[model samples]
Target: MSEQATTPQDLADDAVVLDVREQDEWDAGHAPGAVHIPLAEVPARIDELPDAEPLPVICRSGGRSGRAVQWLSAQGYDVVNVEGGMKAWEQGGKSVVSTGDKAPEVL
Candidate 1:
């Protein structure tokens, strides 16, 4: 299958952002408005994922999210991998939120 990747800037304002990182990683930081669904729980929680084109999946660096994009694509969910993942998102100065009062930082 062909690869589909997008940068933080390319995403639509109302895009469905799926963060596939672990629980702790998500607590540390994540794109504002993005959904928190860790990679391991994806299969079981597949129904929760939006049935939209170009669903954006992100991880700490991109490996896990890339794998998810592949699987999701095969399942007919037009998914895309967030290149460079949260690291790139942060470097791009994109807005991120955290559960804690402290400023969100990619972990």
Candidate 2:
């Protein structure tokens, strides 16, 4: 069955947002308080993922995060994919940040 997907605005204040994009993509910009774990590394680092409610996974777009959600859910995670991903999050004016003063943006 397809899992539920939610927009940035719909996420709860305490939700855990997981970014499954590549390292460079994550370095560019990501949602504030989001966790960065590349899709390729998820299997090996699955234990690092938060055991929390409304675990929304995201990427540049929804594709990669969607796949990650599928795998994580199968592994017994209470996860969901962020519909439209970071692009939508940025477009929706949600908070995003990078390591430095550079303006945050999706790569």
| Root-mean-square deviation of candidate 1 | 2.0
lDDT of 1 at 47: 95
For residues 3-40, what per-residue lDDT tens digits would candidate 2 score against the true structure? 55777788753357898999878888988778888999
Lowest summed lDDT across 10 adjacent residues in model 1 is found at 7-16
lDDT of 1 by residue, 10-76 (tens): 8754467999998888998888868988888998999999656778898988899999998988888
Provide the TM-score for each candidate, comma-separated.
0.90, 0.90
After superposition, the stretches of candidate 1 with alpha carbons farther than 4 Å from their true spots are 1-3, 12-14
Clash count, predicted structure 2: 0
Over 4 Å off, model 2: 1-3, 12-15
Candidate 1 global lDDT: 0.85
